[model samples]
Target: MFLDPLATPGFKRTLFNAIVAPRPIGWISTINAHGQTNLAPFSHFNLVSTAPAVVMFSCNTPADRAEKDTIANVRSTGEFVTNLVTWELREAMNLSSFNAPYGVDEFELAGLEKAPSLKVRPPRVKASPASMECKVLRIIEIEPIVEGDTTSHVVLGRVVGVHLDERLVDAHGHFDTLRAEPLTRLDGDRYAISGRTDMLGRPSPRRD
Candidate 1:
């Protein structure tokens, strides 16, 4: 199938998301200026850099209404936390994405516990194997989907602190991802877990 993006109107409605399957889910948590907590998940997320430790997530901007609760919260407070979505927490993570009204406490709605963050005001998922507290670095607005309909915004955050489950860490300080069973989004409602996998090592340049 030769999918020409330029010819296909609303190309995203086609195979854009499906082709980018198995995206790591970033279960985000934030607190509004009034201290109201909110939780949501974003499949459009990934690590941006490791030197300064940055992560990014993208979300749609409602053209006719206010921004998403999570986005608004971070804009107001300049902080948020990225909670790892593991297999066990998948259900809660799904429920927390509900389009609830403003000031809704998603933690209570999802029946999940929260843990204090060291360098940020937002709390982390207590049950998550890992969480990264971040400070907002920039929010870049992308071109609108169709102009006056909806738009997308990319958020770049600098990881200020990280909380992890000690059991998932080895003596060499490597993370045991297989043991954590991190969850990922595969297109639509389908999802996947980091289970068994093959391994390979990079060849040394000198070996040639």
Candidate 2:
């Protein structure tokens, strides 16, 4: 079956998300200029580069046409934190995804405790196994091609500070992802855990 995403009648965007199955969730935390904290989850989030330790997450404008608190906070303060969601904190992470009003503290709403970041103003989730304190590199506005399509803001950040629980780190200083039991997002209402991870090595290049 052939499907033209540009011409699809309904759920095209959702279909796109499902096609990109099992995306990592960036549980983002940010602070507004007035020092209000915001926490939210974005499945369209990933590490884009390792040289400078950069990560990015995208935020879309809702039907109300108001900027999300995370986006607004990032723009306001130029910093944000990426918190790793673990199996034990799955319910708290889900609870924080609620569409609460601006200035509403999702940390309190989700019953999660906040830990002060070392280099950034935003606080990290105390329960998270790892967190990245980042400075905003840029925010790219994704313009819509067709009418009625919403705009999305892609926020890029450079890792300035990192917090990792020693329990998840090995003697070699490598992160034990399975031990951390990180959580990921599947299409709609579905989620995945990384407890049973598989290791694969890249093949050596063949000489011509």
Candidate 3:
């Protein structure tokens, strides 16, 4: 079926996320100036560049129309940790996404352990298989594409430190994606895991 977001009067913001298929969950952890910690998942996240090791996640305005704690904390502290979510921690990750108050600590609410990060004030999820400690490059407020679009902010961070569970790595140093079983974001309350695995090589260069 053909759908035109701009033309449709009842187009949903979720349609964009749903059409994009499974997206990696950026289980971000951040701390405010007063040491208040927050954790939230953002599906609009990905590695933007490799040379400088930068990653980005987009946070949308909530129903309350107030600034989200995650965005405010990241702006205040200039740091955050992207904790990789796996099937094992799915429930905890979901629990942390609740619309808690500003000072509420989601880690404590989720009953998850927080491990000190090496290069950032924000702690990492101890149960996560991997985490990227990042310094905030910038936070850009996204302009509305259509008139009624809610406010959104894109947070870009430069990866300053990384943590990988040694148990998930092989002797050759390749981290097993299948073993990690990373959780992915889906439409509504649905979620997915990296269940199957395969590889495909790039085509050879065409010779004249």
Candidate 4:
């Protein structure tokens, strides 16, 4: 069935999010100016560039609340880390998604270990197989269509440092996807892990 987005109520957003299936989950962590730590998982996140190593994530404000802790902390300090979620850390990552009060330490609440980052104030998840420490490059605010409705802000960050577990690296210095076993979010509460069938390679371009 075809429906116009302007006429449909919430259908457009629902369909759009679903159509972008199997998005990489970014378990983002940050620290406010007061040293208050916060953690949250965002599915509206992806790597945007590699030249300067940039990644972006969109954070939407709830109906009655202001921006989320992740957004607030990033705005305050201009730095955050995108911790890769694996199957083993799924439970702790899920716990971080809860709407906790300000100054709450999600790392402690979730019972996960924090690894000191080389280039950022916010620490990375020790259980994460890979994590990227980034500094905020820009925060683009998406204007709301209705009044009193907070907009979604897209935060772009430049990766300054990267941390990876040695187990996930091959002798050739290549990352092993099987070793990582990264977890992805599907629609609703469903999640999935990449399998061998998901692997593909592109043929080299012909110079005729």
* TM-score for each predicted model, relative to the true structure: 0.93, 0.95, 0.94, 0.92
Candidate 4's TM-score: 0.92
Q: What residue runs in model 2 are displaced by over 4 Å at the alpha carbon?
A: none
Give the clashing residue pairs of candidate 1, or none: none
The residue-by-residue lDDT of candidate 3 on 1-208, one tens digit each, is 7778889768786887788979999999999999888899888899999999999999778878577888888888899999999999999999999888789999999999999999999999999999999999999998778777778999999999999999999999998888899999888888999666678899999999
C-alpha lDDT score of every prediction, in listed order? 0.89, 0.92, 0.91, 0.89
Which digits, one per residue and each the tens of the lDDT, describe model 4 over residues 137-168? 99999988865446899999999999989988
In candidate 2, how many Å is residue 10 off?
3.7
Instruction: Judge candidate 1 at residue 168 and give its lDDT.
Output: 99
lDDT of 2 at 170: 89
Tell me the tens digit of each residue's lDDT in model 1 across 1-208: 6767657665666266788888999899999988899999999999999999999998987544568988888889989999999999899999998888888899999999999999999999999999999999998988764544467778999999989899999999988999999999987798999656887999778864
Candidate 1 — which residues are off by over 4 angstroms? 9-14, 145-149, 206-208
Q: What is the lDDT of residue 152 in candidate 4?
A: 93
Per-model C-alpha RMSD: 1.9, 1.5, 1.5, 2.1
